[model samples]
Target chain A: MYKHTTDGLRTLLNIPDNYQIFFLSSATEIWERIIQNCVEHTSFHCVNGSFSKRFYEFSGELGKKAFKEEAAFGKGFYPEKFEIPAETEAICLTQNETSSGVSMPVADINKIREKNKEALLFVDAVSSLPYPEFDFTKIDSTFFSVQKCFGLPAGLGVWILNDRVIEKAKQLEAKKVLTGTYHTISSILSKAKDNQTPETPNVWNIFLLGKVIEDMNKKGIATIRKETEVKADMLYNYIKDSNNFSFGVEDPAHRSKTTIVANTAIPAPEVNKKLEQFDLAVGSGYSSYKEKQIRIANFPAYSVEKTEELVNALKKTIG
Target chain B: MYKHTTDGLRTLLNIPDNYQIFFLSSATEIWERIIQNCVEHTSFHCVNGSFSKRFYEFSGELGKKAFKEEAAFGKGFYPEKFEIPAETEAICLTQNETSSGVSMPVADINKIREKNKEALLFVDAVSSLPYPEFDFTKIDSTFFSVQKCFGLPAGLGVWILNDRVIEKAKQLEAKKVLTGTYHTISSILSKAKDNQTPETPNVWNIFLLGKVIEDMNKKGIATIRKETEVKADMLYNYIKDSNNFSFGVEDPAHRSKTTIVANTAIPAPEVNKKLEQFDLAVGSGYSSYKEKQIRIANFPAYSVEKTEELVNALKKTIG
Candidate 1:
């Protein structure tokens, strides 16, 4: 079942043949893994919202020399302003910051990767997969949990990495560095070879993910990507014209295609309460923006008609 | 939802108020956590089977001084002659060996605890939970994945530990020792205080576990344990006199009540094939004993009547 979805995910995401896909507990666990397996000393991070900033903190907590180029909660890091340490062994970035509804553009991520050729680039696509067309060659690894665009419950995380990532862990092992014991890169590789994991995995979730991938494959990736753009555009255009709300993220280019955040005039709870009347539920502002912002996910589960209904409901809701 | 299950588990198992129940990825992962958080220098393992041996290996992988009192496969260690190092900070034991169908007597576990007063006692109850009425006061920590005995699909692991385990982690942290970053004991406590986990957990399975616990509580633990013993005795007695099978574990006292194993005259698969006609299935022996043995799980899911039917089918197939 692990191999079935792993292969389906490869086809669904256009994951390269060179990359190996494995499962972990969650995307957050991968933060510790990247630090343990790849970084020997210094690791760098592009910190913006809660999740990206946590990657940096995880490195620091592991006694690694962690350096980061920080940004505000609703902001993002640009490749032009990145000040990574010269000794950094790995560069961590979040493709989509679910907390702030901000996305670091894929082109910008590729630019950072080009600049740090010697370092392993780890991308956290935790809440924004199947919607993003990643150039797999540009990054050494990328991971996501099923709760996001895949629309399953959140227990299983998919880790996609190249052979270079495995070799990096081997090199660290040879140098007597502790790259962890269970779910280490080498263990993942060995267990994956047998269609097994070191531990009894969440078998149910893997089976569910395979079924989801089969459905998505039937719908087609290009079509899903196109529908995501159209729905996101519809919601963004409606929120732009609404009297009650404006964009949560300041930069239009950095706005996420899957998670759309809005800065509301009224308290976010009131907006949620009004939306509840129409049975349209969206997330309240995360962390510091709890009072003024509302977040909506434009996942595969949301159809064009449903998104249109949401926009129509918002028109009546805010007024 | 995590709290709901954690609370239900406490009630179902009569887990002490002093012991905290938290969830992890799997029981195997907890082996790594034990080595990291509790063992600052040395960990001792009672290595009798595949799973128990792996716990000792995990300590070595994490750069800890690992010591083990070894026993042969399908055998168990008695507390009569333990050569545990004085420097050992934690003592590890597997209450039930899934691979070998051997269980360490809980009385002996308490004896070991009495001898190693200063060291934390950790129990791996992976395949034998809701059956072993543990002396939680005698053990600092114990863990089990929901797949076994709990009768759920594998993925989530439940870690039950005391305040002393948390204090040990803090002491290590104070001394500039690494006890992992994501799942360090202190982080589990801090996040658990907020009724949250550091990672997005398997929310669905946790919910399922709560539902299962509610059912188990309805049945009552004492009734379940009695049923388990009754069913196990029926199967073991039938196997002992059968033409085709004999006891897998030499010592009757060491034979597991939950996981009952037998040495088969035919290959395990042929036995399984014979049983299949009666709509019954059993596990092939793990690893080295795969050909000559069969393992039957006597979990809460089994009824006395159903077990009798299985026993009757075994008779017909063997004859």
Candidate 2:
């Protein structure tokens, strides 16, 4: 089952030969583990929204000296202007901040590696993975949950790491630093060699994820990503023209392709209530934006026709 | 789903109001969490099999001073003669060693409490939880995975801890010691009060577990325990009189009622292959005993009549 999932995921995501995938409980846990295993003293973060801020906070909570180049909610970081400290061991980035519908362009993510050549590059591709064609060799590590782009039930996290991460972890072990017990990098890698996990994993999810990836392969990755962009453009174009709703992220370049967030004149619950009549529901805003915003997930499951139906309903409610 | 699972679990196990239930990935993870949260300096363990030994190793891996009283693979601990050092912060016990099929009698577990009143008592009821009716008030903490007795898919762990655990964790925090981050005792307890978790948990498994527990509740715990014992006695009695098989655990008093292990004259795979003809399968042994023994599970899903069929098949294989 492990081999099936790993092979299927590798093929689906176009994971490069240099990178290896390890499974964990969630991307939330991968945050904790990155801080535990990768960083020795200081780490840098690009914090723009709730999800990005959490990785920074986890670094601090894990007793690391965590630094961040901060941006307001719904804003994106300019990697050129940001300076990671010389002591930074790892730099964290959120490819798509689920909280505010902000995405750091893949070009921007690639630039961080060039600037901070000594630091390990870790990206939270949580809400966007298979949709984004990343040059896996450029990034030291990246992770995501199955519940997002894969359209599977939540429980499993796929962590993709390269050789540098392993070297740093082995060095830390030699220094007698406490990494973790069951899900340590070395332990997970050892089991991976045998097509197993250190503990009994979410077996059902693994099997389901494998099946989902196989189907995705049949449909083709290029087709899926292209359809996603088409649907996203439809939703954004409608929101652009609507009077009652506006783009959540002001910059068009920073707007997320997968998670489309918008400011609503009416409360989010009211918007959700109207959508519920069509048997269509989008998530309410997260954290402080609870009442002010609505989050529409532009997943593969949301077809173009279904998205068109959503847009027409939007016009009827508050054109 | 959190409310449903916790409420259902509390009723099914008759958990005291003073105790709280928090979920994790697996009982294997609960071992690491206990070492991180409960023990500051040292822990004592009864080492008889792979599962219990893994807990002890986790303590040492986390850099704690771990001491243990050793027993052979198939033997039970003699709590009266074993002395846990006064400085020991936690005492670990495996109620049923699935690897060896030796159950430390609940009375023996209760005696550890009488003698080591100061240390926290932690039991790994991994393979034999809801089946054993323990006086929850007498033990400080116990944990189990739903895959075992609940007969559900793997990935959810139930950690039942009393208030005393919180006090110890608070003390450790005050001293600036590192407990965990996301699933820390304080964080989990806070979310649990709201019927929530710190992160997006295994929602599907939690829902399935709640449904399973609800069904188990309707059937009643006493009746399930009685049926398990009846099935166990049937298997054990047959093994006692058979020429091809014998009890895995030498001490009759220590044999498990949930996991029935038998030393087979024929290889376990051959026995399993014979059983497979009848659409039946039993687990081969753990670790070194993998080829020499067969482990049969007496779960609630297996009725007395079904167990009788298994027994008849066993006789046909080697009568």
Candidate 3:
């Protein structure tokens, strides 16, 4: 079966050819590949979650300069502050930060693009692609994992690049030191355009992904996104009303439409241990907030019933 | 089903911790990732196959210094006249070149290692692991694909690494730029050691690989290797007596015992196309030699009768 990950992103992002597109096996790989290859130019990272911090660290590793506009986990990126460096070749942003459960608004993306006309825009939509309102047209390269939005197996990353990215890759290919292999933009372009792969491709995952896309198309991304919003609202409402539970992010506007990050009266690890006993798994706080906060994902496959179960579990565990 | 792949090269080579390990979904990914990441280091391509040349091209694209010691296809990498660069930091060698049907001798590898202790050794043993005489002691990093020898459905790569390689990754991590994500050495090391993966791994493939390995252990790698050797000999002897066909690589010592590369008086593509009519699919020559050679694989699963059937088909098509 043919999987249209890149095509899906292209349609979503409306990417142009002037951009430089690349794919790594994971969102983390994207950060690393960019830092290693795009050393000649500066990158602007719109920070919110661990992934954004990873980009910041990646830039430091490459000894390149990057500008960061930080926001709390639930807060969206500040487009006005994402000033493209004079030598900036790329502007990096995450469409939806999974860990923080926050998403950058389309208006914010447009404003950033308006400010940085010469700079190529790259976005990590790993967690945001499934939502109906995600505007792909403003970004040069947008990437996600099939496992997240498509509900397929992980291992394959879905990336879409416009003609500009393709041209950059071609130029790089001509220079002869294109450093990407299995996930190289050139190789992926070559194979994907032809509905083939450079080496033995991931057959099973791609097959399932194709099926997932077909199923989603039939169900409509809009309907799915609406359902996700409803689920998020239900959980958020419960958490907000509960005196014993509080949100990690103070701003309601920054709240995630998919994953809800909440702080409980009880210690996070203790709550996590209790949740595990009930066979429920929720994400723990990473980095600075470790053992302090809990993240609940309301992805497509996660039903209202599951959310109810989690809410009840949280109530019982907290009590 | 824990499948093994060329990714296993990381452990087989016992790469030092100070060197970074990057995984592209396929060995092809390695070529591109290297080009993107290792611009400062020169690469020495020692193996004789399509993959080695591809690596050479990748290095050339980067304007990075690269040298290839071309062995005739189906012949192993020979140490003769294989000069190591004074500043060589990496050597790309295929433990078993599947397309060429050749396996490099360990002695050649020893010579290379002795000559360039500072250079990281990279091997593609996609077709030669867990079999008898497959040693992983000297190299720094090695890789393999699951489909060829691991007896699992394709999609996953089983990569192993030593402490030294992990340390090198730490340095990369310190730099905060890693070339891989899901395929990263550090991620794979932590998860794989526990028989798990960082991303949603190819669970089915892993299960199949584990089963295959268990069966191999039960039967013994030595016994399996011996049987494979016998199988290759049987097919080779049959080809030797046939006037209509000839081996692609002239030297018997360098020819792979797993895959048999044969050249027919007729164009290889025509021969392969004709053979497919009988439900027998053979690999056609890759790249430059597309119509020149046909590769018949003698995996452990192929019995003596199957080998005979293939020989008869060859005779019927060309003789």
Candidate 4:
């Protein structure tokens, strides 16, 4: 099941043959574990939104020399403007920022490889996957929690890393640095060789993931991506033309295809209540914006017709 | 659901009102986190078997001064012989050695308090709880995984700690020591105040744990404990009187009431195969003894009548 799921996801995301996949408890835990295994001293992050910013804080908390080039919330980072320190060991990028619905283009991720040829490039594809058409060869690692795109319950996170990431961990372990207590890169790699985890994993979720990905495989990744794109467009176009609502990310290219954030003129809770009356549920703005913005998840599972119903419901309530 | 489960377990286990319960990913992960959050310098482990030795190794992995007083496999630690260093920040104990089926009596745990007044007492009740009637006042912390006694799918771990454990973490944090990155005692406490976990947790498993514990509550803990004792005695007596089998632990007092291990003249796999033929399954011995011994789990979920069937099958097959 583990291998089948990895193979299916690799084929779905265009991941190369050499990249290794590891299962973790959650994406939040991966923030610290990635720093422990992959980073030696400095970690440079491209923080455009809340989720990316939280990852940045995790590096600092772990006593790493952490630096970040920030963009405004709901804005994506431009690769050309990123002035990462040459001494940085890892360059962290959130491919899609779920909190604010901003996403980096595949081109920007590839450009990072050209700029920082030495540093390991890690991407957080938490909200946007199977939709991003990511060229995994250009990135050292990419990870996501299954709940977002795979439409599974929370608890399992998928971490992908290249051989280079493993080698770096080997170097650090040889240097007698505290890479981690358990779930170190070496332990993870050794366990994966046996199709096992160092600890008792979320076996149920892993099984479900394999089955879901196989089902997705039969349906094909291209079809899911195309449908996701159409649904995202429908939602974005509706927000664009509405007087009472506006797209969170002003630049359309930077908008996430999975999580679509909309700034509402009315209180977000009132909007949520109105939508609930129609039995259409959308997420409230995260953190402080809980009453200020409406966040809608437009994943592969949310069909085009259902998204259209949401748009229609919003049109009636907001207008 | 978490609160309901915790409440049920506390009532069943005789846990006090002030002790806090926090959920983690696995019992294995708890080994490292316990050292990180509670231990500042030295940790002394009463290593009678594999699991306790693994916890000792975890302390060493995190650059701590780790010391262990060893006992032979399937033997319990004698507190009178323990010469623990006064500077030890924590004393680790495995209440039940899952690998060897040996349990540290609650009396010995109280004796440790007499010797080490300063060090926090940490107990790994992974395979023993809500069966072990632990006195929470004597121990600073204890943890268990739901897959053991609760008979749930593996994923969630429950860490029970007292106020002193929190104070120790705060002291370490104030001293600028590396307590942890995320899921630190401070972080877990802060989030748990809001009745939430620090990250996205195993929601489904937690729900299952709550439901299972409620069912156990309806049946009552006293009746469960009495049944477990009777089943354990039945199995032990069967091994002792049999020509082909004998108890793994030499001292009857040290034997685990939950996991019962028996050395068999026949290969462990053969024993397992014979049991499988009866439409019953038993675990082979762990690791090195995999071919030499049989391990049987006598958890709360295993009914007395079912246990009797297993004993009867063993009687006919071994003879």
Candidate 5:
């Protein structure tokens, strides 16, 4: 399962041979490990919405000197200047903000690297993986939980980091800094060389992920990504043309292609109740926007036909 | 699933309302979280075997002043004096040493309580839960992974800690110590109060755990414990009487009723191969004892008839 899944993921995601993939319990745990293993004291975060802000909070809780540049909610982060401290060890960027339905283009990663060549560039591609068309070589690492884009059950988080991350971890361990307990990069990498995890991992999920990826490989990632784009476009066009709702992200270019959140004239809960009458359900706005926004997921599993049905349901509910 | 499982677990394990259960990925992760959240600077570990020693190592990696008193492998720890440091914030004890099959009696918990009045008492009941007849009130916390006594698949660890543990974590937080990252005790408790987890947990396993606990509740833990004892007695008596094998633990009182490890004159691999002819499989000895010992699990799920079959297979293999 390990060899097959690693191979499948590499082929599906266009991951390079230099990059290494390790599976953890969740993307949240990856945030903890990233700070512990890669960052020594300070790291810079570009926060567009909730998940990016949560990563900043995680670094702070781990006793790191966490600095952040924040964009307004429901907006994308555009770095005018990489005005980060020279001693910063890493820079965190969110490719797709699930909470606010905004995404930063892959070009933003190159810009960060242009300013700071040494600091590791980390991306939270939680809701955008396999569909983002990311230039993986530009970033040092990226992570995602399976429940989002893969349409699998939660419990497994896939973390892809390069050899530079390993070097940084070894440097910290040599200097007697606390990387972590068992799941530290040095410990995991040592065991991973044997195609194994550090502890008794979620083996069942790993097996299932392998099977899913095998199926995805048969269908071809290009076909999957194209279908996802069409479904996302259909849903987005409906919301844009509707008078009763408006897109959450003001710029069409900045709006997330995976998770589409919209501001509705009716209360979000009320709109959800109307959709429920059609045997359709969608998530309410994240956190504070719960009352005013509705979130729709255009994942790979959501077929073009099903998405069109959902669009029709939304139009009838709004009317 | 949380409410049903919590209720069913409380009934099956005789847990009081004050003892809270938070689920993590594995027992290894629990060791990391326990030391991070419950211990501030110093802690005492009573190490009998490999698993207990691992817990002590975890504390050290997290930068705690970890002190340890060790017993020989396959021997139980008996504290003659409470020689632990006064500043120690937590005391770690392993209820059953899974690697060596030595268990500390429940009565010994009172002896430590008598010495240390304020420190949090944490127990690793990884292979001896819902059948150990533990007086939960005597210890502040105990944790177990479902793959052991619960007879479920791996990946879910249930931690039962009381308010005292929570208070200790809050004190560490107030002092600006790193309690942990996202799954810290305080963060988990805050979410558990709302019957939730901090992140997308392994929801399928949680659902299965609830169903398994409901079945156990119906079977009654007492009946299950009785069967386990019977199985352990059968296996232990066979080892003692057979010329080819002997009990691993020196004293019968210290022998674990859940996992029975026996020293064998024949190489353990040969014994396993012989048993395989009967279509029976047993675990190889852990770590260094791999070739010299055979470990048998006396979990509740191994019914009386199944244990009898295994015993008969062992008799034939020895003959």
Candidate 6:
């Protein structure tokens, strides 16, 4: 948690001393804090998946006006297509949509940043940060959870901020700040800087994450990414050749290498139930495609043997 | 997550359907949600420890006028000491102060309820809910986290609300309700009733907690409390006879059986550093007493063997 919250930002993102960062117990807490803190001006939501859509909904509940540019799930929004309103103060995007198995390219984000210099850019990189090529220099604020790619338990969220976002947060704090026992970002930032947490943190998980990050650095992030890509490719190839299965997202370029989302002709719930009987648990589709799709994650820690077992189980269950 | 979010309140707190309830992610979230949703007139905070003090701070930040009945950190507030202000909309109290190892008796809350029927009573039971003696019938809202006596990892918070609190929430939702991705009480409650979560929850920890709760039910809450008391007694007995050790909170009746807060004649940070060598990690003092105090928790699942090992290590370090 220490490395991800502090030095990790310095190394991965060119986080300057002027920028202030805060940690939340979860990425979802980030959205709650954003609504409570930064909801004065209109926020623009460029959504392609469930998580981003949820954020747009959250902004509305806070009585904040929002301009939304949403594509079909698993499709990315081109930067040129985004029409930001004059009142837009923030642009929110999910760098990678884990549930749909798609990611927005860096070029797209750069284009958006070039267009909206005044609007703060916020990215949800929960499932993409450590394994994928993510440069924090492009966004104003980015948030990631420890559980997804960091190989740590789900409890803590690491949020990185640029100087502009920090300025915005300071302005918000001066207003109607809702300081709670565990949800105070200002309190969390003070403790996080000291390698501590405001409330009783998941100390065991934080200890383990430090070890995981150390191990990752030793192994090299490039090597880990390469291995993950190969694992994802192997599964994608199998799905392509299979007569009964098809990829959920139409565009190959938009598909996520970390999570493989597939559509089966059969009902997803039935297939999921059958897969579970074989002791193989696959993610059932969420939202619109709930009954029609299933997601298989090829995270960094998933060994080749386990991947093979899952493939074998899939073959047997589908057959 | 399912049992607690759905049936835990009904089963554990015996909350009738006639008494509406709401679910929040954490106790802190509840405070903010209450301010955003239920603040009307003014709130009264019984400030005796960190949790209650934090609530008073929250009200101040929200720009809501609140009255604080100040008591020392280790003592409970006498409900009859002050007349409830006619403008007071709610009365908040921390059932147990984890930092001070102090718990307020339920009868004290009942006394407040009798005196101020117009003011809704809120309890921060983060450290005391799971104890066998915690009766839920007297308060309007009670919240706790899974990490404390629940023996579950931290991420999710457990909360119970009476009809009055629920009615207040409903009234606010009818007005301008604050929406949250993970911290929204409405989202958690809606999904919880169906054994689901608003967003992706900490599945592994939630699964572990289900198992732990099942084990607790089998063991019985009364038996669990009795065992914890015995464990506290054994550790406190050792502390009482030790030459260099002393209880931080002087009041015997107010001391927490779950968390034994002790102040050593020696500097705390120095003694804590020494204790780390034995792999016995105890909590450090918060705020003003950071240099002189340490907190030892004897919650459920923390074995007697472990406590004995900690005691031996403490003796050796002090000697």
Which candidate leads the pack in DockQ?
Answer: 1
Ignoring the other chain, what TM-score does chain B have in each prediction? 0.98, 0.98, 0.79, 0.98, 0.97, 0.86
Write model 5 residue lDDT over B236-262, tens digit each, in one string.
Answer: 888888988898999887899999999
* Model 2 stretches with alpha carbons more than 4 Å out: none
Cα lDDT computed for each candidate against the true fold: 0.90, 0.89, 0.65, 0.88, 0.87, 0.72
Q: Residue by residue across B1-319, what tens digits does model 4's lDDT show?
A: 7778778877777778778889999999899889998888999998888888889999999999999999998788788987889899999999999999999999989889878889999999999988888777789999999899889888888999999999999999999888776689999988888778988999989889889988988888899889999999988988989888888998888999999998888898788788888899888888998988889999998998999999899889886
Candidate 4 segments exceeding 4 Å error: none
* Residue pairs in collision within model 1: none
Residues A1-319 of candidate 2: C-alpha lDDT, one tens digit per residue: 8899889888888877778799898898899988889888899999998888888998887778999999999899887887888889999999999899999999988888888789999989999888878877678999999899888888888899999999999888889889989888998899999998899888898889889888889999999999999999999999899998999999998999999999989999888788877887778888989999999999887788999999998898768
What's the C-alpha lDDT at position B243 in model 6? Answer: 88
Q: Please give the distance, in angstroms, between residue B12's alpha carbon in candidate 6 and its true position after superposition.
A: 5.9
Candidate 1 is graded, for docking, as high
Task: Give each candidate's fraction of reference contacts reproduced.
Answer: 0.88, 0.62, 0.44, 0.75, 0.71, 0.31
Candidate 6 Cα errors over 4 Å, as ranges: A1-22, A151-153, A175-185, A232-242, A269-282, A303-319, B4-26, B151-154, B177-182, B226-286, B291-319
Each model's DockQ score: 0.87, 0.77, 0.40, 0.82, 0.78, 0.36
| TM-score (all chains, Cα) for each model | 0.98, 0.99, 0.83, 0.98, 0.97, 0.84
The collision pairs in model 4 are none
Better candidate by DockQ, 4 or 6:
4
Q: Which of 4 and 5 is the better model by lDDT? A: 4
**Clash-forming residue pairs, model 5:** none
**lDDT tens digits, residue span B94-127, model 1:** 9999999999888989999888898998999998
Evaluate model 4 with DockQ and give the value. 0.82
Candidate 6 docking class: acceptable
